[model samples]
Target: MNETIIRPNPSIVYMIFQLKTNQPSSKLIYSIGPNGVFPDTQGMLQQHSDAISTVIDYSQGETSEVSYLKLRRSHGVINMTSWSILMIMGYIIARHFKKWDPIWFYLHASIQTISFVAGTAGILIGYALSKKVDANVNNHKNIAIIILVLGILQVFAIILRPKPESKLRKYWNWYHHYIGRILIIFAIANTIYGLSLAKEGSKWFLAYGISIAILVIITIILEVRMWIVARRKTQSTNNSSHPQSLEFAYQT
Candidate 1:
């Protein structure tokens, strides 16, 4: 049987075929031109056919290209979903559930932990996939590394968090919040890049886009409501502070 392999960039094409029925040797014929077509050379073909070839045995447990592609797709899904939950839902819980106090903290921590684990698993899978394919996706790889590092730092910061009344608590909070925001930004960008590379279609992009939009809307509404409540409390406190006005109103 013969196999044709197409390299993505530079568009090189290779055709591999067995030389003899009794031998395990194979020969490779490659072409470098547009649309897998190039000038045919009888001398080159004869030379390759006469030379010895190395047989690649696949009877053992070797992963096929198709399986590698499937694994890559799965990795992309895991990473994208994990980061989305970590950034969107986690932020929502932290921001809107301030009244819940320690409970909100626990909930946020649990969600973040789960997402981090999933994201880490996905990154590992991606590393393996890239190795298998010998890919040179520098942008995607660099962004993923940054995100993982930020995640690890965030986790460690939580572990060593100071008490609420401690002087270092404010600095810790600033570090955690800013790092998380930057991580989320990079993660989202990397996810979009992965989606484009996979060519998974428009539906996936639409789904994520809608999810982010809804989260933004909810955040805006909650922030406005919190501001209004704070303003009302301030007005009430100011009115209570003016005892002379209160006594004059009573006399009238």
Candidate 2:
């Protein structure tokens, strides 16, 4: 008969066996380091010992802390990307294609719906991973909750949108835009926090930085163009009214 004691760590499993034979109890301990061979003592043991060691190594390797972290990181990345695309890119597209009317609206709505679904799934996965890892990321969790609530509210707002001719349409537009802007800002902040927790490399930051910079630049350009167009339209309208004024003055 043999009593086995297993000690598990982030990267390795240490197994100690105490065998009860005709002689006094003999103790054998073997530590299985990452990508290392089994202890010399393991070779001296019976076939059963070899089988046990193999099982321990395989199990530990599969469920290592590194593997869990990778899984969590993937979830975070997906959530961040989805939210960014929908909130930032989709908003820009909707504004840019406003002249296309119903087409832009449909595109915006579809993107937002997909983003919400992906973000919800990501949050659920993160919660499960946090519990498994016993993580204490209260700020990240709180921000995520806020984002989810705002997203749900946005969806409902769209569903209950008033007709363009209705007086309430103006109020609905204001509420929708303000809430969306807040949600996007908080979502980006939370995503950065999550990246920090994941201990990602500099490349991830660089990628996101570039993306945000491009979005900002494009938005600025579009805004300036819109302003110029509006100004020209106003000038044209004023010039057309000048002829009517001159005719009335001449008759007087």
Candidate 3:
């Protein structure tokens, strides 16, 4: 029987499965936590080699030297997924539901602000990882850049929004709302692309795929609800104006 070995950086979990059997082996290892066998202070390098040594033998060795290269690579994917989700569905939902208090807007703003910072780090790590891995640059990286740009624009509109009673207030609101929605849509697209870029066997990537689908469905529902509300408002306005029109007719 052939034996396989895998070593993954810390903070990342990797599983190996036999393609012929379509089943994961009984032995599973993580790069972090008590089960994590690799030692690089913080799970920098996960290595897979021929299974010459037993699991017990491998687990006994300790090598805790921190490696910058491996740590950066491992951190990028996690941060990118987290920030992308926040900038898209998280903040947008806050905007949609926060009608009663100013705190919702503040919360939305704060989350996106943190997401932007995280996103910046993710992008830098992406650039470095791209050089090392055969990532789908056109499909994943390009789309991500588009999302980052739109996110930045949305944040800018948020920061420069006019006061509530200002003459430009309505326009500012429109800009803020529309741009945020656009950012959400782009973020969703980028997330799907990122999922494709992740390795096929990665459970984390599969979970992300499911989450993206759910977010997309939720966004559609929200849009339909907004449309219904707008239509009702229009109909109400028309009904209210009918009496005025009748009064004008009598005057004429």
Candidate 4:
């Protein structure tokens, strides 16, 4: 019997059953660690995970290095899109498009949700890739985990957002803004760390660097424009009120 199985990444429970039978009792369900052969953190890469379960026993000792290398590269690419592109895009929408009102909120939420989901997937893949490689990734892994936790908090904060006129709204705004800014900082730092570890290529690094530079430039321009617009509106209001002041003086 075929069962449609859907689960989160790195699910802990494991089930074993004969394919030809529809008996639930026959299935043996148990808890499982990363690989069938459980190991400590330092020995994680030594275990034969499903992704790189096979190894050559020949004298040359050529194993699954190629596959794991490709997996590492794929992990890097996923994080690049997730943290670098989607997260930054969400931030831009929320910060720069306030004039869009509620529409900006929706776009920001959607983009951030996607970014969080993608980032989760990237970290999971990174963990799985870790089981297949020997490079030290403790710091990178810790930073990514922190990012995940912060992302969850951000989601909850959105869900529990206070109304504009609420007394607590200002505090909420501060928490949201500062936490988001910190999250972005960590995400960028982790991405740079991953890139350096991957050592993919100079061209890839150049492209990522260029993209970041462009984003910074755009943000600066929009920020200046916001200042200019606010100042012009303030000046216009002052100029319009000067005639009223003169009229009041004449009447007096």
Best by lDDT: 4
Model 1 regions lying over 4 Å from their true place: 1-65, 244-252
Better of 1 and 3 by lDDT: 1
lDDT score, candidate 2, position 246: 100
State every prediction's TM-score relative to the real structure. Answer: 0.73, 0.74, 0.56, 0.72
Q: Candidate 3: where are CA atoms >4 Å away?
A: 1-80, 130-146, 164-186, 200-202, 247-252
Off by over 4 Å in 4: 1-66
Full-model lDDT for every candidate: 0.76, 0.76, 0.63, 0.77
lDDT of 3 by residue, 1-252 (tens): 144456676865455533334553433333322344454766344443212111222354432422244544454455555565776655555746767477776777777788777777777777776664423366667766776787688768877878878999988888777777676666666655555555335676667767766776787888798899989999999999999999999999
Question: How many residue pairs collide in each prediction?
Answer: 0, 0, 9, 0
lDDT per residue, candidate 1, 1-252, as tens digits? Answer: 444444554654344444345655333323233443444664223212111223244466243222355888889889988876466678778878989989998989888888899999999999998786555577898889999999999899889999999999999989988888888888888998988876689998898778777877988999899899999999988989898788999999
lDDT per residue, candidate 4, 13-101, as tens digits? 34433335443232221223454566566634343223323344345645433356667777887888887677888888899998899
Spell out the clash pairs found in candidate 2.
none
**Runs in model 2 lying further than 4 Å from the true structure:** 1-55, 58-66
Question: Residue 201 in candidate 1 has what lDDT?
Answer: 93
TM-score-superior candidate, 1 or 3 = 1
User: lDDT by residue for model 2 over 1-252, one digit each (tens)?
Assistant: 378888989977786675555644122233223344443564542221212111123334332122365668778777887777458887887778789888898888888888888888988888888775556678889889999999999989988999999999999999999898898998888888888877688888778878888898999999999999999999999999999999999999
Error of 4 at 147 (Å): 1.5
Candidate 4, position 234, lDDT = 100
lDDT of 4 at 38: 62
